[model samples]
Target: MKLQTLRLSLALGLASALLAFPTAAHAQPAEDHAPTLAALKALQANAGPGAGVHAGDGSTSWTLSTGTGTVNQNRPIQPDERFRAGSQTKTFVAVAVLKLVEQGAFSLDEPIGGLLPGVVTGNGYDDTAITVRHLLQHTSGIPTNGLPLPQAGPDGTYTLAALVKDGLRFAPAAAPGAAFHYSNTNYEILGLLIEKVTGLPVYEAVTTGVIGPLGLTRTSFPAAGDRAVPEPAVHGYRGARIGGFYFWLDGTVYEPSNFYASGAVISTLKDLTAFYRALIGGEVLTPASLAELERTVQPGAPGVEYGLGITAYALSCGGKAWGHNGAVPGYFTQTLVTKDGRHASVVTNAHLVTNVPSAQMMKVLDTALCESRG
Candidate 1:
């Protein structure tokens, strides 16, 4: 955290100086983005030791990476390296559900209780009161299981039903559609709905319905028993938590089942950027569905709002970007697509104590998209 805090100071200074310019005329030069990348690499080196950025508008694009994949290995982060997408997986799940809605297979306003019966009922949670739209919007009042990843061990695993049962042990956070509460349980339920309606595993449903159609060949959802990320993947690390002390913990490989539908896809920045642009550009979802995806309500996090799986962030620079950001133990990722199709995607191998992307990391995203606006 000390390292990241210092990096934040340097990054802000760099951002201030860079933004001072009038944003070089459109199509000026590819090197015009070098300063943004320099600031990003500096932040990455100090924050997580490894990171990459994929940025550009339709006319110009930049792919860059900084720091090493492994600590002290001198193996630099590659622009094409794969890593866990974390909760960003939600966008894919949401898109899949929305596709079903478009095909007349599911209705957003329909109560999940009617679709799954007694499966979602228990511990004071009334599934009958929660609708598919509520689940996607995180207005279903569902509480997270509240279990941290490390507690689940390296081989963490759980069935969707089991996770839901554990989550139900706590009463619903709010009445149905009462207010916004971001809950991993919400997406897990959507995963079940997909399974129920399509009669397929959540992974297969997402692959066939979302990933395949987009031709994201490098992206994949690992099975519960799988612990190894495919080759050319970046190794992730975290600050070790021992009795009141912190040390470096290598988080390169671990069962992804603990993340499940909430955060279990492996992908590169390239594929992520493409997916986000298509989603925000209305290539995958219908106008009605896209509207549902962009319609947002404050989720109690400052400057952040939640939509059906998608998130809208008001950039510090000016203008807003639509997409979701995610974090697992060893990775933090974000994809932001502007209204005019300018986009940026970021991936970091180091996660903070809070598991949230650092301000400096976010600044990089902000600058990349903001700089590309003109």
Candidate 2:
């Protein structure tokens, strides 16, 4: 399957990696305990793949990595190894835009036509009709760049203008603010906005504005054409469904430049969990901004309803956790942070396959969050 199409499934809540609830109660003792280890082990053992799950409660953290780094091998997955964070980059971009908003540089309701005139008009896309808020909320009606397999290598150069034009070739998905339709193109426009406003590339802006200030030393935004993840990274696998069955193939070297500000960030569980806590815990945004960041569109779904840069999920155990989950071709990550400050992150090496650590993994994540309650 194409990566953007699969990612769109994630946007529509079809392939939401953040499980709301699970039935089996496999609770382990909390004191000096690692509740996710056994579940993760079982997950890898049963699925024939490696996985990494991490949970933190602001003060303490635990990680469990099982299976092999490569297929048909015994090399254990590293607890700190990085993976392509996919659309999680949206959260970073959202935070940057919020910072710009907080600085009085732009208003959420500002129309795109005012921000970038003549840049977004093409193939039925009305740049003047969409707003920055519409872009952040995925209600901009922009369509995704329908690349079957992105032809860009890690070193290839492609402009954001080119990507926006690529997306414009397709008809608009819906009218502005008509309904939620997640498109990577929305963030691509935002990336261009950042560059236009700040005169820095999107990656440089995020690095200086978000990653560096947060002290996320292990996280990185790879330069264009830098297909290789930092050393000590786990190999990513491709799971293709064929004739009602699935097969696995190696896909670790997949290039990320094509995703750009939409989904190109790479991070480890530790860094990713820290980012979730910091983001949802009110560190990166003002109280008013955080409230706006979490303002929901639905009553019961809570975080399931999309917000500015985050998704608020109504935890099955009562109370809501704010987070966003991301999926690329070879990796899928579910990162959740409860309002009470519990954070959980799960990462896998394979993509779009049957049983990509679904319920079993959610059970582990829930137990981790529940343990933080007491």
Query: Which residue pairs show backbone clashes in model 2?
Result: 154-225, 154-226, 155-225, 303-312, 303-313, 304-312
lDDT string, candidate 1, 1-374, tens digits: 34474355445554332111111112123466776676676566455656678888866677666655665555656657788889999999999999999999879999998999997787777878899999999899986667743334344677777666666777888899999888888888888899998999899899999999999988888767677778898888765333433234567687777778888999888888888988988899999999988888898878888889998888877878888888877788888888887888888786776535467667888888888877
List clash counts for every candidate, in order: 0, 6
Error of 1 at 288 (Å): 1.3
Q: What TM-score would you give candidate 2 relative to the actual structure?
A: 0.83
What stretches of model 1 exceed 4 Å from their correct place? 1-35, 148-156, 240-247, 355-357
**CA RMSD of each candidate after superposition:** 8.0, 7.1
Instruction: Provide TM-scores for the models.
Output: 0.86, 0.83
**Least lDDT summed over 10 consecutive residues: which range in candidate 1?**
18-27
lDDT of 1: 0.78
Model 1 CA lDDT for position 316: 74
Give a tens-digit lDDT track for model 2, residues 1-374. Answer: 66565555455653423222112212222444455676666655434356776776757776666656665555555557888888889999999999999999898889988888887787787777899999999888875567643444354666677777677777888888887777888888899999889999899999999999999988987766678778678777664433423345556776666788888899888888889898887889999888878875542332367898788766667887777777777787777888667888877777664455556656657766766665
Alpha-carbon local distance difference test for all models? 0.78, 0.73
